[model samples]
Target: MVYIAGEEMTHYATELFVDQWIKPYFDISTWETYDLSCKSRDVTDDKVLHDAVEAGARIGAIFKEPTITPSTVQVKEMGLSKAFGSPNGAMRKGWNGITISRDTIHIKGIELGYKNQVLFERHAVGGEYGAGYNEVGAGTLLTTYLPDDNSPPFVVDKRDLTDDNNVVVVYHNPYDNVKELAHIFFGRCLEHKVTPYIVTKKTVFKWQEGFWSTMKEIFEKDYKDTFLKEGLLERSGNELTHLISDAATMQLIRWTDGGFGMAAHNYDGDMLTDQIAQVHRSPGFITSNLVGKSDDGSLIKEFEASHGTVSDLWNDHLAGKETSLNPLGLVEAMIGAMQHAAMLDVEKHPDDASKLEVKMKVLNFTETLREAMHNTFRYGQGTRDMSGPSGFSTEDFIGKVAWRLNR
Candidate 1:
C-alpha cells in the first residue's frame, strides 16, 4: 500500500496520522510513501501523482493526506514551473476512479456527530476540473473531433464573440465513465445494506439525465434481484428511486435515521458532501475513498480525508504555536486502506488461516483506532476546534490514541 502526504498542515499532520497507526499495528518504516506535497508536486512536475496512482493499482490500495491545489498566487509564491493541476484529479484519471465515498462521523451518546452514510459522487475521465481553457479576446470557437483519414471534423459547439465578450470552451465526457460509476454506486449500497438514491438534475442538464437513466437501468437489470434477496430496501420505493438533485439535497439535511446511501454526479456530490460535513460537524467528520476496478481484474483504490489541506493550521504550526487540528478524516482514510488491503488478501487466500488472522487484526485495530478518537470525547477531552472540556495539541491528541490502543 502507498500513502501520499500532501502540502500544508496536512503535510505535518499526515506524518503523525501515519505514525499513530503503523507504530502500533506494523513496522512504521515498512509502509511505502510518496510526498505529494505542493512543493514536491511542483519540483517533480507531479510525477509523484502518477507513481502513487500506479502503485495503488498494483498494490490494491493507497491512503493520502490532502494537498493544496495551487492558484496563480500560490504558483508565484512557490516559484513553480507551472501551476500544477489537482493531485486528486490526476490520481482519479490515472486509476479511472469512481466517486470518493463520503461518510459522516458519529460520536456515541452525543447527539452531535452526523450519521454515517455514503455519498457516491460520479467521478472519472472528465469534468470541469480537468478541462484546460485560455482567455480569448475576440474569436469564433469551434469544437471538433475527426476520426480518421476519411472522416470530416464533427463539431460539438461553435460560438462567435466580439471583443467585449470573453469566453472559454471546455468539454467533459460523462458517457462511458458513468456506467462504471453507476455499478460502483449500486454495489456499494448493496454492500452497506442501505436504500440507494441517485440524484441528478435532469431538468436543467439533459446530458446529466443520462446519468440517472443509465444508473436506473443498471440497478434494475443487474442488482435489483440481489437487493430484494438481501431485503435491503425498506422504503415503499425500495430506496432505489430517483430524486431531483434539489430534493435530494433537502432529504440529506432532513433525514434522521441516517439517510443510508446516495449517488450523484460529480459537481452535485462535491457541493452536497461538503454541506453534509458542515452540518454534521466539521469537515474533519467526513471520510473519503476513491476506487475503480480495471478490466484486468485489478482494483485501483485510493483513500483520503475529505477535507482540504488545513492552511490555517499550517500557519499556526509554522509559527511554532501548538494547534489542535483535526486529523480525523485523514486517520480514518488510513484505517480504510488497511482494512481494504486485508480484505483483498483474504479474498486471494480464502483458506489461509494466517491471512484471516491478519485481516482480523487489522479490523480490531480499526475499531481501536476509531474508539480512541472518540475516547477523547468520552473523557471530556479534545482539540481546541472540538471545544471539549480540555483541549489537546495535535501531538497530544495522537498520543491519546496511541495510549488508549496500548492501555
Candidate 2:
C-alpha cells in the first residue's frame, strides 16, 4: 500500500503498517511515503493534490486525510473579509466525492444482452432501499446475484427473487459527484424495478445546484412511468418532493419507518452511513461498492473497505507495541473487489470456467477471513498491548488476520 501522509499524525500510520503489518509479508524496500504538508502543497502550486487524485485513479486505491492549514482556517474565519476573493470559501475543497455513472446488469442465466436491456434492468431496480441509515433500517445484506454452472443448484438460486422486493435509498454528500452518482444509483433502481428519489436543497443553491436538478430532469424524462407507477410521484398529499437537506434528514427517519427509497447528498451520506454501519455492529461487515463510469452505462464495479486509517491505534505500533486494530475491513474490501472483478471478467468471457473458480475462491476467502477474526477474538490468541483496557496491539490484530488468511 502506497500512502500520501497529509498530516504529521498520518505519518504514524505508514510507519505502523510498513514496519509491522506489511513488511512481514512483502519486502519494505519498494514501499515509499510522500509528505503533503500545506507548505509543500503550496510550494508545488496545488499540483500535488491533483497528482494524488490522478494517482488514485490509476492505482484504484488511495487513502487521504482531510487537508487542514492555518491559512485555510484563517480564510474561513475571516469569511467576508476578502472582498475580492472568489465567491466560494478560500479553503480548497478536496475532490473526495466519487464520480459513478455507469450501470451493469447481471442476469442469473442470460447471456449476450444489449446495453439497453442491461440499463433498463438497472433502472427498474431504482430506490429499492432507503438512504444511508435508512438502508440498514430497511434490511441487511443488499446483494444481487446470479447462478453459474460450477456452483451447486442449491447455492445458485438461494437469494434470487422473482419480483423486485428490495428498495435502495442512497445518501450522497455535498462534495460527491451528484450527477454521476445519481445516474448510476437510479439506473440500479430501474434495473431492479425499485423506485428511486433524490433529496436535495437545490431550491436554495440554484447556481451550485446543477447536479441534483440534472438528476431530477433525467429521471423525469427517462423514468417517468417507473416513478409514477410505483406511486412515488404524489405521496401523502404532496407531489414527489425534493426536500432541503435538514428536512430530508428528518424525513428519512420517518420514511425508514414508512418504507420510502431516498438518495441523500454527500455529507449526509457520510454521517449516516457511519451511523448505519455502527448499528450493524460490524463496520467490517459492511460492503461498499464503487460503481464506476462506463461508456455502455453503469457498472457494478469496484468495492472497498469503508473504514478509516485507524490513526489512534497506529500510534501504539510506533512505540513498538501491539494493538487490536481490526483487519476485517481490509479483508472484506479485497474480497469484494476480487468478486466484482471476477464477475466482470466472466461477463466478458462467458466460456471461461476459471472465472467461476476464481469467484468461488474469493467468496471462500471472505468467509475464512471472517472466521479467523472471530476465532482469534473468541480464543484471545492475539497479543496484547497496554494502550487501553482492551490491550490489543495493532500488529497483534493484523497478525491475527494474516495468520487466518494464510491458513
Candidate 3:
C-alpha cells in the first residue's frame, strides 16, 4: 500500500481500510506502505512517489490512497519547493500505467444515485495532465517534433496570434500506450461480460482519432473472433461500436440498468469518470485501477479509490469530533490489489494446486467483505455521508462490517 495521507480523514480512512477489512483476510506481512502525504512528498523531493512506483512495478501490484496535491497556498504553508504536480500522474507514468478503470458502486436495495457499473478505460500516459504550457508574449505558436538526424522535423501545428491574447497548452499521445490501453479495455470487458463502448470526439480534434482508431484496429484484429465466438455482444448485436464523447455522456447519465464499459481519451475519461462517480452515488463508491502492459507485454495494475483525500471529513476529525468516513473505495482498491497479486502468485506456481485454494480463499473473503458492507449500508449502518446524522462513526461502521464477516 502506497498511502499518501492528507488532511485528517484520508489518513484514518486508509488505516481503517487495512484494519477492518484487509487484515481479516490476509496476513499483515503481505503488504507494506509508502507515505506520499504532502509532508512526505516534500521531504523526499517527491522521490517517495517514484520509489512507490518502482516498488509496485517490482511487486506487480499496489493499492494507493488519495494524497494532497499542493497548490501555491499549500506550497507556502507546507514550505515546499514548487507546488508539486499530481502524485497520481507521476506514478501513472512511472508505472507505464496506460488504462485507468473505474467501476460504479451499488449497494443492494439502497438508493445509490445511479445503479450502473460504468467502466472507463482511458489513455493514461500523455494528455492535458502532463502538457507543456507557459504564459508569455506570443507571435506565432508552433509545435515541432524534431526527430533524429535521419528524420526531418515534423511541424505538427502552427498558429498566428494577433497579440498576447493567446496561451497554448499542448501534448502528444504515444501509439504504443494507446494500443495497450485498448488491449486491457477489451480484455476486461470480456472478463466481466460487458459491452465495450469506444468513446471519442474524433469529429473535432483529428488527433483524437488515434483513440478510436487504435481500439477498433485491435478489437477487429485480435479480439473480434473470440468476442463473436463467445456471443459477447449478442444483446447489442454489434461487433465494434463508437460513440462521440459528448453523446456518450448523455448515454451514461441514462445508463441505469448497469452493464457496459467505455474507452475514452485521458482528459475526457478524467472528467467523465468523476461524473459517473457522483451519479453512482459518491466518489467513495468508486473502484479505480491503473492497468498497463510491461516491456514483456505482461499486464501491470495498480488500484486506488476514485476519490481524493477527504479533506472535509478530515476537518471534522481534526476538530476532535466523532467522524463517519466511508472506507468503501479504499477497501475496494485493497481487494483489487490482493486479487491482482494472487493472480500473479498463481501464475508463478501454476502446477501448485495449493495456490488455487489460496485464490479461492482470497476471492471468497473479498466478496464476503463487500456483501457485509453493502448489507450494512442497506440497513443504514453507513457513515454520515450515506445515512445522514443518524449514521455510525468510522470505526463503528467498519466494526459492523467486520462483525458480519466474522459471522
Candidate 4:
C-alpha cells in the first residue's frame, strides 16, 4: 500500500501522522512510504507527485489527502476587488466555489483509465425534493422549474443486445435511466456468462410500481433459457416465497457468501455495499464504480471513492485541532482502481501471472487499515468524542495502519 501526503502536510507532520496515528497498529518496516511534502516536490520539481501516482497505479490502491488549498479568509478580508484589481469581479465560481484543476492530481476515472469499468453510483434522493418536502409548499410549486414546458418527451428505447460483456443496472425510480442501463448490462452479462439480479419493492407497488415489474418481466422472458442453462434459476425451498425485494436481498447475501458474482440495483446495491464493507469492518476498504452504456451498448466505467470528503473533520484539521476522519473509502477507491489495472494486465499477458499477487496486495491493504483502526481505539488515542471506549484521533487511527503496513 502507498500513501501520498500532499504539499500541505510536512514530512515531519506526515511522519508524525503515520507514527502517532498509524504506526502502533501496523508494522510498516517492510512496506514503502514516500513523503511528497511541498519541500520535496519543489526539490524534485514536482516529479515526485507523478512518480507517486504512477506507483499507486502500479500497486492496487493509494490514499491522498486534500491538497488543493482553499482561498484564504485573508484574501476575502482584503476585498476581492483590491486583491485582483477589479471593481466588480467574481472571485470564485464553480462547484463549491472551488475550481479543481485536472493537473493538480490525476483523479481516478476522470483522467486515467475508466473505460469498460463497472462502477457503483450511490446518492440520496426524495428526502429533500419530494411532495411536501421542499421549502415551498408541495402544491404551491406546480411546475417546479422554469422551461418545464420546453422539455422534450420521455423516450424509451428497446433494442437488441449489442455488447458482449455483461452489465447490471439497478435503481429506484420507475423512470430512472438506470433501468435502461440495467437492460443493457443484463444482456451483456448474459452474453459474457455473468449473472445479474434486480431487487425492488414491486410486491407493494404493483401497477403503481410498474418500473421494476416491467424490468423483471423483460429479464425473465428475454433471458430465461440462458439463465436456466447457466444454473442461475432455481426454485426456493418453500412453496410460498417472500416478496421480490426480500428474495433479492437474500440472494445477494447468499451469492456474496458463496463467492458468486452478481450486480445489484441502486438503493439495494448501496445498502448491500455498505453491509459488505461493514462485514469486512472497513467501509474505506471498498471501491465503487459508475458505468454508462453507450449507444453501441459498450460501457464507460468511472471509479470514485465510496466515501465522501470528511468535510466536518477537515475544518478541524485546518484549525490544528484533533480529528478522527477515516480515509478508508478513499483508500478502497485506489484499491479498486489497482484491481482493475491488474485485471487488464492479466488479460494482456496471461503468461506472466500476477493476479494472485495483486489480490494479496489488496488484502494486505485492508488488513493494515483494519489493524490500525483497532490499535488506535485499543490504545485510546483517537478523537476525544470517539475516545470513550472506541474512538481515537484521526492521525492515531491512520498511524496504526501505517505501522502495520511497515511491519
Instruction: Pick the TM-score winner.
Output: 3
lDDT (Cα) of model 3: 0.79
Instruction: Give candidate 2's error at residue 187 in angstroms.
Output: 4.7
Q: What residue runs in model 1 are displaced by over 4 Å at the alpha carbon?
A: 113-118, 137-139, 148-153, 160-163, 225-239, 347-353, 387-389
Best model per lDDT: 3
Ranking by lDDT: 3, 1, 2, 4
- Sorting all predicted structures by TM-score, with the top scorer first, yields 3, 1, 2, 4
Worst 10 residues of 1 by lDDT: 111-120
Regions of model 3 farther than 4 Å from truth:
1-7, 224-239, 351-357
Clash tally, candidates in order? 0, 53, 1, 41
Better of 1 and 3 by lDDT: 3
Error of 4 at 17 (Å): 8.8
lDDT of 4 by residue, 282-386 (tens): 444455544332233322232344544445565667898876554544444444444554454455466765765665665675555545544544565543443
Ranked by lDDT, the better of candidates 3 and 4 is: 3
